[model samples]
Target chain A: MIALDYSQFLTFEPQHHWRIGIAIYLFLGGLGASMGFIAALYKHIFKKDDPSMFAWSTLLGVLLVNFGGIFLILDMFVWESFLHGHITEIFKVLLAFFGAAVFNGNFHPWIQWGANFIALFSLFGTLWALSQADKAAILNKLGFLVKIANLLKPLQSVWGWGTIIFGLAVAAYTGFLLSVAPAIPAWSHPLLPVLFVISALSTATAWYMLWTYFAKGKDEETQKVREHVGHQVEWADIALIGLEILAIGAYFNYLYYAYAGGKYVFHQMLSDMGFVIGFLLVGLLIPWILEFIAAKKHIRILVPLAAILVLFGGFLLRYYILHYGIYTYPWPS
Target chain B: MQEQQNKQLPNWVFVIDLNTCVGCNACMAACAQENQTPYWNEKWRTKVEQAEVGKGDNIGRIFFPRLCMHCQNTPCYYACPTGATYKTPEGVVMVNQDLCIGCEACVTACPYDARYRYDYEDVEHNKQLFGEEFSIHQLPHIDKCTFCYHRITKGLEPACVSTCPTDCRMWGDLNDPNDPVAEIVRSGRAKPLAVHLGTDPKVFYVGLDTLPAPAKEEAE
Candidate 1:
């Protein structure tokens, strides 16, 4: 008897609907916004005496959150829907089921909702902090706004912690967004969220360091403050970089041992030697080593370069995850 | 209440007899015509895939008609952020075009690669078949095989089943024990694709044992 050919029943084509440009922009925006929120919180809690640092950090956070929100809107298929008021229906449906779905383990909706909530909250918080700092002197000229800022001074600490929590949620939400996709075996891991959070933190730290070193004024007082904060951030980044490496290792190990499909996808991803070498070696490993050296030798130039590499690696990580996510073809039984 | 609801629901299933399939691709053409899908769009709601197996004198080819599996526990349904893709009481999975944000979440969540984003312009030619208010062509929406829900609900067989030249496709309510498709499925001869994933797909295949292994090089 002649056997039927079962394997060729269907041809599986890898989808490229979610382009690399969207992935990179979304990743950068989310990372920048979250980092800005964290930096503002850190300044408020630890360096309250330095009003100038708090103002700068708050301004950076506001700018990043707004930019991130813009990129997210651009990535939507019908972004004009938001402006035309068509998105209200989507919002209405989500609002109706938000509580039930969250309790029922439907976290996809929650992740999207949480991201939006955090973006708005962080934006408002940073702007409020900026007005209170009055570094630009624009807010001080507005008498009514200055009174409101003073009235809200007692609750500033609460807002600071709230922004920090929401920022972290935004970071974790990016990972959760991709992990929920069951088709992509490579991204469906439980540890994907952990890996993403660590990467976000490392990238955030790197961005803060870069901004402090390069974007700040070159006056004697500002230079002294930048040097001090840069040193502290360098140590923090080293620790973040170390944990990021560990997370990456754990993520790959989990994929290799989880199942045949995961293992196959993992090998397939690595087969594209460019991604592994560009993202892992040059993007991650080289930067890690350079950051370590910069920390010990106090090499200012090396620190910024390492920061740039960390950002580059962060972009590549998201790029590779979105572009190379191959759906496991279900072999006919 | 739950028991009453379950009893009221229809159990829809599709049966494909591999022994009778001639790999003629009539079903694919009928589906595209019935759905009014744009000619330029590469993605099809229903498609026939050909696989060549074995080597030398043993070489043989088989045709597999693929579409949305309509699983009992659909991953795409769960992954949808706003409930845009949902399963009806009749066991048919559907995408609500109005609610779909075209985030492609459902597309990525489906293991079958059955769902695709509709990127074509709306042609006015099919307005008579599908009324102007509810034309089949909708831009910037995720689309997949809906089991020909409009026709099925109207007591008509799906276009693919009706147009099949070899009578290889079977469509019926699986809850009826006397239904031929249900009988074939209950006979334990039919196998669901990716049973290990636990999707509990409604579509089942018979005569799989006679099918040759897919060529390894061509699998990519």
Candidate 2:
């Protein structure tokens, strides 16, 4: 017989508070943060003279983070209030980074911390991306680009490291975002942050693998660099996917025995075909096996395919966590 | 902390005698009129829930009136990112509409499932029903049972407490020794739900063991 502190669960109700906007916000935020971190990590280690995928990765990081902020806006915007609409919401989000009271620390620290990290990462990442040696003559001719790059040229190393620090922090913060809400037992597990951070890193690696592999306008020298970096990224992603599997397995096991509503979530996830087929089979296991085979056999096509699936799996993880959380009622028994 | 800041404000408490509630949803109807809650969407500030309690010989059915517990250790207050939700000196939790950004974190964090979004579209509908201005809901914010913060602060009991035909519901200052509600709670006749959560709810219930045995006929 299955043993439990109490055979009966506390509250068998699934939480329906946060909708799809919050899920998309988490997915985009994690993806953007990790992308920024990986871009800086590559530039310092790989030592590229010309603008490579790393430069574009930083550009993507800035864009993705800014785009992710839109979802947060929609989620938090109060339409009925006197102050409303798109511009005000954007201003409010930006204002929070500049010491606005949007994040009240009397209660939650995760959202506040995440905001600071994203802001810092965006600032440094933009500076670093602008400083890259651009081949496009038209871009270099722009007065602001020339002036900004030249002015900030000396502190390029500091900017690169800043991106790496805050990027990693923002990625990890996404996990802590949901973990702090103890009302949802399925999400309150400490392992959530560990799982999310690892997944973020893996997804970022997958993105780099795709970018380097898919680049078209590269010179012979840059092409050679891209190929070498692409190979290493593929191998790194293989390890990350493996680690992700281990983390998820450990998390699932712990959730079952630890939380009153956790067992329900565990079974609920297992019962859902999306978790099994979409996330596990197609997203994780199959892609993992394909990447391993592609690495061993030197099949170039399989790497991109695996990377695509890995990215899909990464997003699905966020979706399931946000959507499927069940609340266990604390009642007098 | 709230009491220390405002010495004049009395600690509020709600005592619901479960035995006296006759499954008549007068409290729910009264709350709907007073609060203009989203009754059309099956959403209510207060509800009469038909609950099956106990097991074996102890098993009995009862209609329990449920609402925000207004905990001493308020989870919703802590969970709010904008400090929109806060407890007043009188111990009634309230959402400051001006500050509420509608993040819904407070809604998710409340274990009692007390809060709901008062969206923009509903205001237009409410305007059509009961003119432009209605019951401190001009702006969209997280709505919950405020324990009639407006009425209670102005020397009146909550709509539900005042309207109950059976006198099942009681509203009084917990600090006042003369108040019977405080006596009922202190004497251990009424107990708060889910004490393990550490919410320290101001609302309490009595006679949850079984439906009050049918009132005995008085002897001649």
Q: Which candidate number would show the highest DockQ if scored against the true structure? A: 1
| Residue-by-residue lDDT tens digits, candidate 2, A61-126 | 878876886776657653323344446544553454234333434535466666677888899998
For candidate 1 chain B, the 10 contiguous residues with the lowest summed lDDT are B119-128
lDDT of 1 by residue, A1-333 (tens): 545445433333455766675576557655755665666566666663334555555566556655655554444554544544557644543443343334444454534555565555565566546546543335556677677677766776666666666667777777777775665676788887787787877888887778777766447776676667777778888888888889888888988898666677678778887788989988899998998998888787898899999888888888887776777665432
Clashing pairs in 2: A11-A329
**DockQ comparisons of all candidates to the true complex:** 0.34, 0.25
| Native-to-model Cα distance after best TM-score fit, residue A153 in candidate 1, in Å | 2.1
Candidate 1 pairs with clashing backbones = A4-B210, A4-B211, A4-B212, A8-B51
